[model samples]
Target: MPLNEEEAVLLGAAWQRLAGGGPEAAAVGAELLDRWNEPHRRYHTLLHLWETLRAVDVLQGEAADADGVRYAVWFHDAVYEGRPGRDEEESAELAARLLELVGEEPARIGEVVRLVGVTATHRPEEWDADGKVVSDADLSVLAGPTDEYLAYTAAIRAEYRHIPDRVFRAGRSRVLRSLLDGPHVFHTAFGRAHWEARARVNMLAELDRLASSAPLDLPPP
Candidate 1:
């Protein structure tokens, strides 16, 4: 799908902020908008990118490199081919290439690229404050109110529509369990204060729902 009006506006704004108004930055934004508008996308669409950037802006005070975080937020899902780590890797590579084209400093471009891939695990070295900020912002949706969270779940299910229900539930349950088992779902202190409790509640509720569903062995059609 082509980028919608609101999405195009958001992309333009992000590019203007990052690129400081130029054709090269506009081209980079267009490339990212194309990926976010890909027909197969659901939850990882421009809406997600827009919301994530908003969240980052809200948390910018805590970031060691707000610029890098913003750049990463724009391109983190730029190559969502449905493979987890591979998708992040490819997105990071794209970020590097595009940032270089726009004449971003080598160090800043490296940081942006690293941040894009860092999302694959949502974990960073203890000293990586920027990584924590981006990770927490990316996952802020999990802690959103019930209605919004439900919508996010629906969108994600639609994105993976090809997967069988039973298989999807099992895989999703595992992902939720991993987060629940972790010491912290949102690494930053502000994130913990704002989202940790609610995220846990939501994840546990969803996991319970999955557990109660009937088992099936049929393959995806």
Candidate 2:
């Protein structure tokens, strides 16, 4: 869904803050909107961005660098082209350049870039409280109700329409298995308490469905 008026206002405010509250902020915000609103996007559209920013707001109390986390959330998927590590690498680099253009301090820009890159692994260092906060928020969707989780999976499938079904399912199952095998799917205490159990339940159910599906045929060697 497109953002409501209030959410749009809040997004503008965030951009203004990050871009040093100059006239250039509007231009930067428009550019971001264009990128995220690209027609080919399904799940990583503005709806996801707004949801993530809302999550950041709800969890900022736990962040060591709340502004950095917010900026990271906006830029993390900014360059998403369905290429995992490359998407993150490009997003982080673009975020650093944009923040620098806004005359942000080098340290602050570095922190934002670092936070954006951390989403690639979704594993933050022990001392990276801000990273933990953003990571948990970014993954908060996994904890949603079953219907929403189903919808999310469907949206993801839509995003990767180019991939054949068998290939996509196998790749998706592997990703789910990785999440299931993790010590904790969510890093923060709040995320652990609120999202961990539900995410596991959702993942396990999806994993079972995936496993039960017939395997793709292979040609004789």
Residue 106 CA error for candidate 2 (Å)? 0.4
With a 3 Å backbone cut-off (N, CA, C), the pairs that clash in candidate 1 are none
Tens-digit lDDT string for candidate 2 (5-37): 887787777777766667566666787888988
Per-residue lDDT tens digits for candidate 1, residues 1-221, read 23478876766787788777778877777777787888778789888888898899889998998988999998899899778899999999998898998899999999998899789998877899999999999999999898788777877777777888988998889888887888899988899998999999998888877788654322232
Worst 10 residues of 2 by lDDT: 212-221
- In order, candidate lDDTs are 0.84, 0.84
Clashing residue pairs in all predictions, respectively, total 0, 0
Clashing pairs in 2: none
Error of 1 at 43 (Å): 0.5
